[model samples]
Target: MNESMEAGMEQYLTAGAAGAVAGLGVAVPLGAVGVLVLQQAMRDRRAGAAAGAAVAVVDAGYAALATAVGPLVAAALAGVEAWVRLVAALVLAVIAALGLLASRRPAPAGTTGTAGTETAAPARVFVRFAALTFVNPTTALYFAALTTAQGDTLRGGAAGAVFTFGVFAASLLWQQTLVVAGGFAGPRLPDRARVWTFRAGYGLVAGYAVTVALPLPAL
Candidate 1:
């Protein structure tokens, strides 16, 4: 097959096997991710399992999608042909620094489930989380690194396209799971308990920052 020849020749262009595996690692946050999860748990305690599930879904969805298509995204960037190293480094440094700060921020009032006496504003809450998460700079770094590493694998035309679709599917599956769980837990938690739950959540964020920056010497 003509495609087979292209596949064979492609190995010469990039890291291939090792790079594909590495793509997954670039987004594996040892620190901030946990903090966010815990924070979500605390915030959604009153929200019931559904709220928690939603948080998880969004988190996992983004991560998995970022991992799978990272290569394609990076390839697009490679074309920019600018001072990429400098740019990536600067961006990463700022993100790491911000993570440290975000960890220390005061937890917001209200459990994700805790609703105003008026008909609960589910849409607004969902939108709020989306905005907060999408704005995080570290997310950009994670995706950038992943895509850059996967860029080679994604160049194989049809095979590459299939891989990206699989990645997207996996991401969506994980995120949706989280959303369902959060929704279930939304209405079960109490007042004071929810507040400290989030403090713990922020603590995890702080932890993530430390882990990413220092990367505890591999055991």
Candidate 2:
């Protein structure tokens, strides 16, 4: 290959690699969203996949924004950080409450399927999950810091797009793994067990909300 082609390939590869690492860095932590994803996966694979995809898309969008203007966006968010965090905590609390209530109620007889239990329609699931993931500006801040640290590796429009795609791909891979694991495990679990499992997941989400609302002192 000629020098220009070699340089182009290297740029794409570097951006993609950086994005993959950043994606995993953000997604790997089993936070409230992660717990919900696993729980939804246990209940319905399609809904879980839909939820996961929404999260990946939002993550990618944030990554792109961060790459294009990391410092400026980060600075803008800092002014309203408290409000953003408050909104996130409240939303999470509401979701947890709804999930707990849903677990107690019997599934509509026809709705629960062979694969697992039923959730809202996949389209609704996608919007809800997307909103849940997008409300947290911390994810964007994370990518902003990462891009700043990496300097120009993620610069340029083409490089940014490739990086965003890489983030989406890596995040989707991890999210789908959780979904598949839950799907496989759901069938083996008794109905009572699954219901309790969902309850526990919601409880965790509630706890996460508390953490988000109140900052803990550094150890």
- Identify the leading candidate in terms of TM-score: 2
- Supply the TM-score for candidate 1: 0.44
Could you tell me every candidate's TM-score relative to the true structure? 0.44, 0.89
Model 1 clash tally, residue pairs: 38
Model 2 spans > 4 angstroms off: 113-118, 216-219
CA RMSD, predictions in order:
9.1, 3.2
**TM-score of decoy 2:** 0.89
What does candidate 2's lDDT look like per residue over 167-192, in tens digits? 99999999998889888887788888
Off by over 4 Å in 1: 1-31, 34-112, 115-153, 215-219
The per-candidate count of clashes, in order, stands at 38, 0
Candidate 1 lDDT over 1-219, as tens digits, reads: 889887765643333333333333422333444334333533443332333334434444444455556555566666442344334334444544554454445544653333222123445545544543444445555645655555555444544544444443443344444445544554465645544554455555444434444523333
Among all windows of 10 consecutive residues in model 2, the one with the lowest summed lDDT is 110-119
| Best candidate (score: lDDT) | 2
